[model samples]
Target: MATALVTGGAGYVGTHTCVALMEAGWEVAVLDSLENSSSAAIDAVAEVVGRGLRLYVGDCRDNSAVERALTEAGPDAVLHFAGLKSVPDSVADPVRYYRHNLESTSVLLEAMARHGVRRIAFSSSAAVYGLCKELPVSETAATRPANPYGWTKLISEQMISDVVRSDPRWSASLLRYFNPVGAHPSGIIGEDPEGAPANLMPYLLQVAVGRRAELPLYGTDYPTPDGTALRDYIHVMDLAEGHRAALEALVSSAGQVHTYNLGTGRASSVRQVVAALREATGHPLPCREFKRRAGDVAELWADPRKALLELGWSADRTLAEMCRDAWAWQSAHPQGYRR
Candidate 1:
């Protein structure tokens, strides 16, 4: 088994990816600061693997810390998932967002360069394609990020591209993820957003769990079938599997920077998602229409053909499966790891 270093492996996506890597027989080492995440996430990840994982409590911004972690982990490849990801919060505090998201990556890249870690898989977001004219977005779509958070991710992608191009020895994979929802089938660990949930699934889950009174339906006047915003909601497990496939590609590639869109190549409207959640949870979620969010887009999904064709990766989970798993986790842990 090859050793893989996972930065921010205690995060929602990172924790799931760590478990996926371990399940695939990879020796995983996690470097996390426990800022936005809790150490309990690592425990949940270990529970998924039925054993312990190599975890180091550290931040990605500290070059020395990153250097020590990578050196000690002796990773053949690195997965970068450490960064702040909140659109409204980023809008309120742009500099903080830029500093954390960009600076952390710069530090991680420098550490990887110094430690001779040649391969990397970056966790990017579909937010990079803000207000796209295309329905199902491709990797080559015009990337005009609507919010500061999206811009930071785009800048990070450019940075990775530049670094990889400057050195042929560095092979990188930039995975632009669509909306990631749901949880593991075991319902042990799942999306646990702090404060009010910004994403739809988590917000809806909170409502279903009776934490929130009702779902504030944002923007019910879009040009979609349900006249609400539409997006591609991929299961987190599928996203984890896609990361595994991407890591395989990064290792097998000819030392070139590659980018892929991680999605299910399908779109679901806000109302559609609510309906699916209601069906999955057997709860009629109360929702009220509200004004559109400032940076909300009408419709945004992904054209994941590149991943399917190149990496042999395709999302096998359905929307019903996503809602079911998410509801299961929410029902099991209403407080989300606090209990």
Candidate 2:
């Protein structure tokens, strides 16, 4: 069986992808810093997969730590997911974001080169295509990141591309994801953000479970059907499956840098998501309107046809399913993984 090293494997998407990788018969090793995630997540993943994974506790930017994981795990390819992901957080601290995101990738790449591991599947974001003018933005859309977080992703993509161009042995799959929400259907593993969540779904879930008072509905005056921002929210499990497909493609393809946007090809307004969560949790889910946050886009979705065609993967979960599953997880673990 092939082996893979997953950086930040204890985080939200990383944990689910670890389960998927194990189910697909790949030996998995996880390396995480436990900064924004809990090691308990890896335990839950072990339970879900009915097996344990190698856990290396450390930051991705630490060369010695990364090299230790690489040496001990001896993975055939690396699934790079270790990075600070909050956009607002990035806005508040651009240097920290750039340093953490860029340095981690650079160190990891160097370590990969040292170990002769040339294949990687990078976790990118749709934020890289900031302020997209076209609806359902394609892979070829102009990438003009509006925030430091998006700039980090775009710069990382360029770094990977440069490396691949310089060497014929290197292969990469850059998966630009839209909004990833929901949780594992089992409710054993789900998103557990530190402090307040910057994303919408987690905040809504917290409010549904009474952890918070009400949702702060940001910007209700955007040019949309409901005068609220629209986004493509894909289930976390579907996004995990997309990673598996991309990894498979990378294993089979030659030295080429492949990029694909992973989404449901449809947009859900903020009001629509609130309505869905209210129905799912049977909560009134009170909300109060607020001014639009800086760096926020009006509408953003994806034409995920590239991933569908190339990776043979397409997201199939409905918004209702997303909300229902999220509620299942939140209700089961009111205190998150700490519980």
Candidate 3:
């Protein structure tokens, strides 16, 4: 069987990707630090996939450890998902963010090159397009990251591009993901943030589950229809499947770095998301609308034609499905894996 190494494979997106890869007939090994994820999540993947996961608890920045992991897994490709992702946290500790996000990715790429692992699917973000004035941001949009977290991702994407350019034998797929929400429909795995959730879906889930008092609408003064920020929220499962497509594309292409934007191409405001959550959970959730948030864009979605054309992938899940699955996971695991 072919082998693949998934960095940060125990986290939300990474864990789901592991399941998708296993279903696609790839032997998978996960390397994670557990700083932002739980070992229980890894176990959940094992249970769902009906196979024990090869998990290594370590940092990606550790060059020797990365080398050993590649040597051990003998991965045919590396799904790069290991990085710090909180915008607020990145703002607070820019140095730490750069060290963990940018530096660690650099080390991982070096290790991959040294070990002759040429195929990679990097987990880039929409934040790399930072507050785009355009309505539907595409892969061709200018990359002006608004925060340090996004800056690190932009840097990492460039590094991957450069690596592929320098080595003709290396191939990579840079997948720029939009706002990824929802959870595995099975309710066994989901977005389980450690502290106060940075993203909207997790926060709304907390409110729906009565763990939090109310949802705080971060921006109510934007130029959008609801005067709030809008984002292209895609189901985590769809995002995971997109990873599989990207990996297949890179492996088949074999000579170029391809970029694709993964999203539903539909922008939903904060108010709209909250309303959908209330309907999905069948609860009276309170929402507190406030002033515009710092570093927030009025509207952002994706032009997924490229992905559809190239990878033959499009988000098949709906907003209702996203809310329903998230509600299922939140209601089932209120404390998220601790239960």
TM-scores for the candidates: 0.98, 0.98, 0.98
Candidate 1 displacement at residue 179 in angstroms: 0.4
lDDT of 1 by residue, 100-182 (tens): 99999999998888888889999999989988988679988999999999999999999999988889888889999999999
Give the RMSD in angstroms, all C-alphas superposed, for model 3.
1.1
All candidates' lDDT scores? 0.90, 0.93, 0.90
Residue-by-residue lDDT tens digits, candidate 2, 1-339? 999999999999999999999999999999999998888999999999999999999998999999899999999999999999988889899999999999999999999999999999999999899989998899999999989999999999999989989897999999999999999899999999889988899999999888899899989999999999999999999999999999988877667999999999999999999999989999999999999987788999999999888888999999999998898889999889976
Lowest summed lDDT across 10 adjacent residues in model 1 is found at: 248-257
Query: Candidate 3's C-alpha lDDT?
Result: 0.90
* Model 3, span 71-180: residue lDDT tens: 88899999999988999989999999999898788999999988999999999999899879886998998999999999998999889989989998999999999989
Winning candidate number (lDDT)? 2
Worst 10 residues of 2 by lDDT: 246-255
Any runs in candidate 2 off by more than 4 Å, and if so which? none
Give the CA lDDT, 0 to 100, for residue 23 in model 1: 93
